[model samples]
Target: MSMTANTAMAASTPRRGSSIAWSDVLLNIYILIFFLYLFVPLLIMIGAAFNVNSTPSITDWQGFTLDWFTGEVDEETGRVIAKGLPQEDRFLQGLWHSVIIALGVVAIAIPLGLSGALVLTRLQSGSTTFLYTLLISPILTPGIVLGVTTMIFWRDIFSVEAGLFTTMIAHSTFIASYCMLMFMARLQRQDRGLEEAALDLGASNVMVFRRITLPFLRPTILTAAVIGFLQSMENYNTTFFAIGGSWTLVTEIGSRMRFGLTPVINAIGVIFIVITVVAAVAWVFFRKREKG
Candidate 1:
């Protein structure tokens, strides 16, 4: 009887394995379809950047040209235009402005976010929930509403001018929440004993924080800084309101789009996409090396 029962179990195992294999195959096919759906638009955009013609339609394959990268001149007006390519000083200036603003936002947001996360983590009361909601409220708010509110609050109430500083502050308001949330999540899983051990080893509070807490938080800090920088750079709605006629890369792109779409924008997109892909690849390698 025992041998018969064992034989029956063995016989059923292959059927169960077959069912799981079929399910996995179907799931992999769905995932592949989903990835292709997401990737096709980006591939089309990158391909279109290399096309000689700037038409939105992707049916025709114009011979590859680099005119979109090399600057062009307006024949009738004799004015230098962003028509053929996007290498003008203005675009460079706009990119520089974005970089500066992103740096400023990171500088202000990181410390504030770290402190906020620390406070929220230490608190153990009902009010902590309210504070969490308050910190994250900006993320839920519409960008346009945030922009308008920022403009009114700064310009009318504080009598501040719209410029780089205002834009940085506006961006930091929401971005800090993202940083705080990332840190808070990391902190939740962190072991407190390491910090306590450092304190017990005759280390001063500042020394303990510098050597122990900061090192542990380095990954989170780097993640937050990168996230904040990217958010500030690509932000359009809040920056648009706070810029007060000041130009940044995103705004410049919007302005150029009003005249006509150009492949130059695609060139810029391609540059950024390449940078992002390279950075991600490097990060994966670095992580693997650390594990090894």
Candidate 2:
């Protein structure tokens, strides 16, 4: 019996397959290299922020210093020689302009998006595709085209110069499309019967919208605001052309990259990285806690 069992076990374990595919191994290596390529620049940039050198480079590393972020500190006098003042910084000035534009985008985009979504969703005709395409054409158009067209149109027609206002408008033209798409998605999931019942019960159209539609869309409104704000903040080409001589933080960064590169720019990048990581972590934590 022992001999028979041993023979059976040996027979069951006798399988020998071909070697692992070189293609799969090469694909995994390629994936690793691809990730490294993407991350290496960010790592180098982050590393330079901690170096004391004025130039943004990791190869010529100086001792660690925080002067770029917190201004210069007097070593002997103990009083800060350069108190980390954002107000005195050109980058900070551009950041303030970015914030102003972002706020303006949220204000304009939310309303336009809401209106567009309303029209698209409520339309009873089958020929609504043309209108939808027309409305969404701005999103498909290149940002540079939008910026140049807006700048020229305003200059020729409205006598408005290309500046912060024009940048805000250029951003809104596409951003509103994003908001409208989000709103349309939410509206599709909505039970229209509730709105109709409210209207039938003598509620004014505005009242029904205010009480029913707005409440249901509150979550979407917040999401659209966040998306629109981020889009506005990160915009470059549109803002560059439509902003005339003015600058936002992103455009300022571009100009610095073109004219003079410095560790201060890396410092700015570090701040952005920290803020993004913190926000993502906090969002996850809050969501988990809420679910629990």
Candidate 3:
């Protein structure tokens, strides 16, 4: 009777492997589908960069060539030559403008964010919530509205026109909020004992800030810079409304998409992909080495 009961319990219980395997299989399938969805279009875009097609298409392979990326017209032979700078003058100039704007955004956002974070974290009053909300309101505002408002304010009040400066300002308005959040997160995790010990040692406020607080915030600063730069570089709506005559790389790409579509665009995409991949690889290696 005991043996029969044990056998009945075993028959009723499900196998562990069989139950877990279904969930594992489903998770793997989901991950595969997600990755494919993300990378399939990028692969197509990269392939088109290599193809010698006028239009950006991977369906019709037109052989491999890098002319679209760095092609130049030969003076004597009048043939397109490779190894020169990209021939899209507007795009190149726009890229430079984008770089300058990104730098400005980082410059403006990081300090402002640090200040706001410090204030919010240190405040012990109810007004802190109001101030925090005010500081972060720009982030919740629509990009279009931010851009338009910035353009109008600068033009009407400061006698400044819509250009790179206005665009940078507009970008910083929202980007500072992101930087503040990062700094706040980092600050929350920090050991207050270190700061208190420094204060007990009779260190001046500025010295304490420079030596302790700044050092503690170094990693956050780098992260904020990277995020701010990327945010400024890729911004469109705010930039479009704020920039009257100037353009950034992303804005130039939009204009090109509207007027002319070419493999050149694909080439740009390839460059961006290469940079992103290299950065990701480097970050992974850095983490592995740090762990080691």
lDDT of candidates 1 onward, in order: 0.87, 0.89, 0.91
Question: lDDT rank, highest first?
Answer: 3, 2, 1
lDDT of 2 by residue, 1-292 (tens): 9899999877865453334356658889999999999989999999998888778788998788887787886678877664343423678889999999999999999999999999999998986898899889989999999999999999999999999999999999999999999999999999999989998999999999899999999999998999899999999988989999999999998998998887778888998888888978987997899788
Span of ten consecutive residues with least summed lDDT in model 3: 79-88
Q: Is candidate 1 or candidate 2 better by TM-score?
A: 2
Tell me the TM-score of each prediction against the true structure.
0.82, 0.84, 0.87
State the lDDT of candidate 1 residue by residue for 104-155, as single tens digits. Answer: 9999999989999999999999999899999999899888777778777888
True-vs-predicted CA distance for residue 291, candidate 2, Å: 10
**Total colliding residue pairs, candidate 2:** 0
Query: Cα miss at 57, model 3 (Å)?
Result: 1.0
| Candidate 2 displacement at residue 282 in angstroms | 4.6
Rank order by TM-score, top first?
Answer: 3, 2, 1
Candidate 2 vs candidate 3, TM-score winner: 3
lDDT of 3 by residue, 1-292 (tens): 9899999878866655676778879999999999999999999999988887778788998898888777868989987665323667888899999999999999999999999999999999989989999999998999999999999999999999999999999999999999999999999998989888999999988888999999999989998999899989989989999999988899999988999777888889999999999989998998899788
lDDT: the better of candidates 2 and 3: 3
For model 3, the superposed segments whose C-alpha errors exceed 4 Å read: 1-20, 75-85, 287-292
Q: Residue 38, candidate 1: how far off, in angstroms?
A: 1.5
| Model 2 misplaced stretches (Cα beyond 4 Å) | 1-27, 73-88, 282-292
